[model samples]
Target: MVRPLAVDVDGTLTRPKPDRGVDPRVFEALRAYSEEAPVVVATGKAFPYPVALCEFVGLPIRVVAENGGVVCIEQGDGDDPYGGGRFGDGVVYNGDREAADAVARAYEAEGHALGWGAVDLVNRWRETEIAVARDQPLAPLERVAAAHGQEVVDTGYAYHVKSPDVDKDIGLETAADRLGYGPGDFLAVGDSENDAEMFGVAGESWAVANADDAALSAADFVTDAAYADGFLEALERATE
Candidate 1:
């Protein structure tokens, strides 16, 4: 059997920001891949987005949303999330929401035009830290987050200002625990700096063609293709 696989959503499964939805091949590949083992969509897209996608696409896969803040277990035929198909994973915070919010407010007050993620209740009603879309230098912002026991890291598409207490690796570990697998039992794949956290933790890691330098450096392998296509190629190699 293939080991449990954790794939990032934005850059790995889908294209970058301003682009939405998974390619049909990616969606179908996920479904086919799931038959081999647990295939989880781990992303920074809040939580509801994954739920809606799964419901809309009829995917039976589990999800790790909000950059691993929570894991929605796959439904076992009887457990439904929205009264019909499936529900999202319960909220699991990697960082303190209160602390994260405090840090976010601090940045926004300083006149940082933050673009809040509307799908996950990032600003108004979130369980962990809020994700703000920003494309700028992060050194200064990093200091701001550090001051409050929080951190702001770029996920390629945005600067996630969050609780230093939790990260994607932490969330992945949590999911592994739930699935009764060890770090060496899976392959982590992605295409950004935030995804680097999964490298050392998983048995193997792959960086898509478009992965940033840091992500590529941390990966065990680098795919020739980019985005969803790269993911499928790497997955093929891994299972071989």
Candidate 2:
């Protein structure tokens, strides 16, 4: 049986921007699952985002954020009492300032107008690469990548020029080691390229119907429904 279930927040739990909120049935099912097993909200969202989500759903569980680069455990009393213990401390992996800067410099050397933003980390995933385009156009960023023989990945909130080597799997492995959980013991669910690594590491993995082609191709199962409905279905399957 899966000891802990790791769930992605954005496309897996809720729809992307313009529509934010959990599905009612999905929330209810998650609450029910929390009563029987440990449900971990594993996403790119950091600190307060995970904390607030737990509060909103009334679930007491651990969270893996920043695409497994950060792991925080929620504790204390009240509906939203989090960030209290060392468990709230996150383990950052790929989204490091140094790495981001290095990539930015590479872009500059290529004569591409580069842009950068400090992602909340907690609200993003690793496979979700960032492009430094806060005040620049995406076309220039693409040109920079092309000049460098690289590719720009759209991470929703940011664009990332990334190497194929870096991804969420590395982050998830680090989190598993820190938390004392084996790869075989956990279940992962997601809906994007960023979620690919977590899906690979977990014993059981799932992708939502709305998942990108890459994510769907890698997932163990694809839900008939999308977003929260897919999450709920995956949870039920995992528990069973």
Worst lDDT 10-window in candidate 2: 120-129
lDDT string for model 2 (61-101, tens) is: 46665555445554333355544464544434454434444
Highest-lDDT candidate: 1
TM-score of each: 0.85, 0.71
Model 2 bad stretches (over 4 Å): 16-18, 74-94, 102-152, 155-158, 161-166
lDDT, candidate 1, 117-154, per-residue tens: 34534455446667776764466667778998777778
The CA lDDT at 138 in model 1 is 68
Candidate 1 regions with alpha-carbon error over 4 angstroms: 16-18, 75-90, 116-125, 136-140
Quick one: RMSD of model 2? 5.1
Model 2, total clashes: 14
| lDDT of candidates 1 onward, in order | 0.74, 0.65
